[model samples]
Target: MFNDRPFPVDAFPKIIRNAIYEVEQHTQAPQGLIAASVLGVISLACQNRIDVCRLNNLRSPVSLFLLTLAESGERKSTVDKLLMKPLYQLEENLFEKYTHDLTIWKNDEAIFNIEKKALMLKLKSDIQRNKDYFATNEKLKDLLQSPPKAPVRFKLIFNDATPAAIKDHLCGYWRSVGIMSDEAGAIFNGYTLNELPFINKMWDGATFSVERKSEPEKLIRNARLTLALMVQPDVFKGYLQRKGEAAKGIGFFARCLICQPDSTQGSRKISSPVVSSEHLPVFHQRLMEIVNDNITLDNKNDRLCLRFSLEAENRWIEFYNKVESDMGFFGSLSNCKDYASKVAENMARVASLLHYFNGNDGDIPLSAIEDAVKITTWYVNEYIHLFSKPNEFTLAITEGDELYWWIKNHCNRHVVPYITKNTILQYGPNKFRNRSKANELLNMLQSQNKILIGKRGKTTLIAIANLKPAI
Candidate 1:
């Protein structure tokens, strides 16, 4: 599910055509009638907007054109292009439609405007004809309730009894809990908005709520002794409601985190689901700063360990080899033993901070020490081998001179960086071998380098780089 392929645009036309065919076959209408009504629906697409009512007629012909493409299974790939042509055609004639000698409802208008009205009329006529042939099923009658054309109800309640002290304890309180719901409103449908303290009130206040409402009257009136057992029970709870200008933007709703189902009933989920990009800018920047500070803290003097620094000028240099990083541009430490030790110690503090936050093992390991040695050795070889054509990797992780010459030969001919890993990535060594992953990587390597030249313990005697780029 994480990596599902996107639906191919080319298949859309065919997919829509099939849906139309399936619906038509089920309805058993004359082919002409079913096809015509489908076209009408497509043509009406551009007219559905409440704000763009002026386009009601103007968009009909364009909508019809889209449906035409939808019907021609092969035309799906160009669906957007097909739809844009008619709209652009209309745009080009916008001036003609507006410049009128005298105002009459239908007379003095652009060609696109006139065509739009004509298409809509055609759509209406076909729809009415198809409507008469439909079966008189009860379900159909029930579904025929024309959507109530009621004007929007903008009136809302915003009374809060929460003490100013408790409500304002935290800066993000209103958003943290559904507090605004406990407001007054003209009673509607026999239910009223609830109001109660959210903070400093536990379940002991059984009626305790930030805001809540009783269930529907029908559910309330017929309660019996076993009613609670008979039903799941309509819950009374505090929920968010918008007030003033806030409601206009948010449409009168409270998206409170505490009131969410997953976080209800004394059991609160830690960390909400991964947040969206729209709200992540400030969060991520703060997170990065914390990480940077933590790393700086970890690299303190006390933590610069050096068990793997047998060849290092100092102990702290070892730990510097780990943590390739998400983002860092810190300069490399000097070879001077004292400076390397200081840098390593400082880096260890950073590692410690990471461990503390993640609640996991945060120790500097022996494998990393070994990997650090390998990295140092590779750095030395890089200077001398910089001009070697097809630079066969010579930095052997666990080897003597024979393995070194074997690597040198491959790069001496082909123009590739021949290299091997001691510290596989920024994290240092994987003491635990992952052969399958290694082989998967091997398969991606030059196929001609198939022969395993030799072996060192469990590790393979293979060229790290040759004709291919270095690992």
Candidate 2:
């Protein structure tokens, strides 16, 4: 059974919950969309500074990959802009500093080049005159060895980039970055998704070599990347239609926390006063604090590793076993075992994020783990709802019910002995627009004696077998 439930907003930390609520009240977007945007920011802010220790004593980055599916006009961009304010502010500050540092570095490099040329000339003249050249040679060596270092330009967010560009940035510039977009057409529709395998390695925090044609092979290690894409349903569907099998085969989608929230398009009214002013400032302030702290840590190449308490470890083990059992042949999640297998790890990662964001120290507590489970369980059901395939019998019954209701409503309103098949195909349910599916449903309904099918002068007609009209 696939369940479509509301997001478990209360399960999040108070800071995160406040931000989600503020965004929801202001934008009136789906709660899930707001929550996803908030979580993406948290992942970006925390990935560089924190690592989590699993039960096996293995360390993993607290990064996350979130994929949100919604229709157009869902206010995804609005919510993301509100949530990502801190990150944008941080990037602006970094760009300003980089501009100043780059100017100084360029001047230093020019001076070093001028001095080195003078030293080389002195060494050549000394050598030609058969004078003592050791002093000039030593000067040249010292100057060459002491060239000014280039400043690191810290960029934290990327909207559109290829895998090669991503690796280059990580290898040369910043070790932590996020790839986020509210409208993700370029990510899914362009060539970015062709490197799913490489992206998968980034999510796993695994080291891999980037072999280049002209440059040396760059080994990408200890690099952290967070992916958060909010795309409309049709774009994602097209990607799935074309490359879903390959993506699944490589376990790329398994690492994602995917959701398709119900759209809140028409119900959003503009009656209430904006209240995000109350909560979003606090959220943004705290986020900037975290990001600034992480920037310091990143420069020092230091990270804080969090571990679970004894009680929390036991609870996590139990939860892991439960998720693993659910992937068995007779279990509810058997259809999506790939996602099921990783849900527990993702739960742990979420717990780590919550724990760190709340300024908790020492070990992660049981309460955080419990809260994370509530959130991840909802995501598990969402994955099944979006990806699970229905059997023929079940699909037939579902579509049959839809067709029956449309026919019953149409017949009750019109005082006609019969309705033409053309009318049903044209004005009926969209799913039954195909002639073959409509004919199959008509035959099934006729066999059940629910409808009578006949011909009226070259037109096929359908009538309710026992019809009644309400007064």
Candidate 3:
């Protein structure tokens, strides 16, 4: 909804004209009533923007963006209307959508789809429009060039989250498939999958200063294949060694999908890795379902995505010829990155791999992922839980739910910005509620030895203590 900053187009004029008429409507009422009526008029006029864009499914936050761009009005009534009306409508819409379906297991494709298109269009257009800025400003355009073999940050919570019991009831709900254990609370660990095609798309978008472009996709493929083979070496590997074509083809697809060297960036805008299985039919079916869901709802964020992408395949080939090319290229892919965000990202991806290899996926099942998010929610009620302050003195790592998990706990009351995958600002400490607390947290971080860096719209702090050469 923003491009670091946004440029208001037509919405500016509408606010100006409406303010004049609002003052006229409230002349006769008493001072209190007049004040309230005038406020109401301005608010209503500004909100009629749903009519202006004709987008019924507009997100609550986007309206605020448009309103911010509204011209300042002189009359108190007009000003108040412009200020508060959009917010009111936004609250109304959000309340209706959340309450009816906030239950554990329900297909949220409807909401997801509406939100996806709105965001994707906004994001894509912004990138396309600013092509010139990126071209001229060498520094800005450089942001899109992904490093080799980037890791996917996977956040999975594994308490008592199970899907089989809730499958019939939930849409986006992920439940544990087999392990029916009360001991488990819920799991929410962030994973970073590699990006394949997106790398190509971004490279294509960039000035093409990259070393190798055409064959980049090939190296990208080998990287994904290496990872998939690594994903389940004992069981799935022996099978893939024999299957030949399907193995190669699916390997290629997986290579392209996961946004990792071993990962394939699948057709869906949603981020998920291709896991090998003896049950191809079931896997295929799930793949189609996920793709369909992604098509229907994938928004600007791709929702949450891995910055990692397959090095263009062709580039991989040259790299192989020049390099060891053994272990199927794991060394080439695991190279530690210099970028600040990518540094932590590599670790998160490795963490997901640890959880995934532990039979957590099939054991826990997919539906529980969202359920696992509760751990993050509970994390914010106070602090100093198991995950809280783990690396505070060391890496300065603070525990909490990711932004989505945080916002969702509030039923996405308003859009909460994310800083990387795991951290976010909780809504509670706003000016009206625990303001001092929020300030204290922010000020404390700002005053610390480390600096905070934001990525994908969220603030992330770097702990000097966490620094280590690539593990």
Number of the top-ranking candidate, with TM-score as the measure: 2
Question: TM-score for all predictions?
Answer: 0.14, 0.83, 0.17
Total backbone clashes of candidate 2, pairs 3 or more residues apart or in separate chains? 0
Q: Which candidate is the best by lDDT?
A: 2
Candidate 3 lDDT score relative to the true structure: 0.24
Steric clashes per prediction: 25, 0, 88
Q: Candidate 2: misplaced stretches above 4 Å?
A: 274-276, 298-300, 390-471
| 222-279 per-residue lDDT for model 1 (tens digits) | 0000000000101211111222123212311111101100001111224444433332
Displacement of residue 368 (Cα, Å) in model 1 is 59
Prediction 1 TM-score vs. true: 0.14
Candidate 3 lDDT over 257-282, as tens digits, reads 11101111111132334432233233
lDDT of each: 0.26, 0.82, 0.24
